[model samples]
Target: MAKHNIYKMSVSEVYPHYITKAEKKGRTKEEVDEIIIWLTGYTQAQLDKELEKKTDFETFFVNAPNMNPARTLIKGVICGIRVEDIEEPIMKEIRYLDKLVDELAKGKSMDKILRK
Candidate 1:
């Protein structure tokens, strides 16, 4: 099977979309950043650097400082697929982020979104 093109797409390319999805629902960029930080364990500065460098999603995850163990608790549907059921590890990680953003846009409390 062919690798999903999303893996090669720059995180910067999709970052704006995540912010836009959140903002349209009255959420803030900082909240989105917080979710990302919680999931990837990237310090704010490191995240900024990755965005500035236009890192691809696969590399971004691969080089994550500390992928939160709690991310395994993220269970939901995204893009019509159950995140917890995804078989590909990288794809699962991507969908986990997507699910979190979806939850945020749907007005879930940050504590719950973070699975705290």
Candidate 2:
């Protein structure tokens, strides 16, 4: 797998890819946004504002209003690396998002995906 500078990557740029992945698998962008909101505790409006401003991942996470407490329960392999074992905090958070998107693409139910 290719390693890219995730911290420097734009959240806005990556978000569309998540929407496309979900949509291709019969999911909706609204569902994708809902998952994002669940993870970051950002309102849809706040997420929209961040996307409009084109913030980088570093900025996006740092400025998140209320990252969910249950996010720590998100565990699994993403890109062959176990998310729970990730040493870097930022990488772990990114992987959590990746896992959520993967679940959505795999047609997992919203309640289950959100760890409800």
Candidate 3:
């Protein structure tokens, strides 16, 4: 009999990719994704649910302010989310984005980090 490919496995099973070339450090693929959710400021349960559609901050900020994944978690974990309270993180992200704009505007050796 032959073994099954990870890509063919369910989300509960194979994840993050079927190959690894480096030291293979860090947590399980699922855990890594959960942490990414936390770092992006999602609540634990919200992070765990894999059913909801995925979204990014840029789209939420531009088109659907009501559809922010982080906002969902933030409202759940913290006090009621106020426009004033969110101003800082939003500004920070905007500044970070603007820095990328500035760097690219200068035509530097844009690496993978900046590309994202």
Candidate 4:
């Protein structure tokens, strides 16, 4: 199968959209960052560095310090597809982040959103 163009797109390219989506609903950038950190185990500084370096989605996830095992628990429909049902590894990881940001924007509390 052909890889989606998004795989090559830099995380920095889509990051602002995530922040805007959250902020439009009164959520903070910190919350979005928290979600990313939880999923990929990137320190705030490391995440920032990746963003500054324009790391593509594939590379960003490939280099994740410690992808949370709990991320498999993130189950739901995002972009009309079930995240857990995605068979492609990189795409699933991308959708997992999307789902978390969606939950935060919809006003789910941090604890529940974090699945704690």
Cα RMSD of all models vs. native, in order, equals 0.6, 2.5, 16.2, 0.6
Q: What is the C-alpha lDDT of each candidate?
A: 0.96, 0.90, 0.33, 0.96
Which digits, one per residue and each the tens of the lDDT, describe model 4 over residues 1-116?
A: 79999999999999999999999999999999999999999999999999999999999999999999988889999999999889999999999999999999999999998889
Off by over 4 Å in 4: none
Q: How would you encode candidate 2's per-residue C-alpha lDDT over 13-99 as one tens digit per residue? A: 999899999999999999999988999989999999999998888778878889999999888899999989998777788889999
For model 2, the stretches where C-alpha displacement exceeds 4 angstroms are: 1-4
Q: Worst ten-residue run, lDDT, model 2? A: 1-10
TM-score for candidate 1, please give it: 0.98
**All candidates' TM-scores?**
0.98, 0.94, 0.25, 0.98
Q: List the residue pairs that clash in candidate 1.
A: none
User: Model 3: how far is 85 from its true place, Å?
Assistant: 16
Query: Model 3 over residues 1-116: C-alpha lDDT tens digits?
Result: 34223213333231233112111532243434432333344454553443233433343223321322432222211223333344454433333333333333334433421332
- Those runs of model 1 whose alpha carbons end farther than 4 Å from true positions after fitting are none
Model 1, 1-116: lDDT tens digits are 99999999999999999999999999999999999999999999999999999999999999999999999999878999999899999999999999999999999999999999
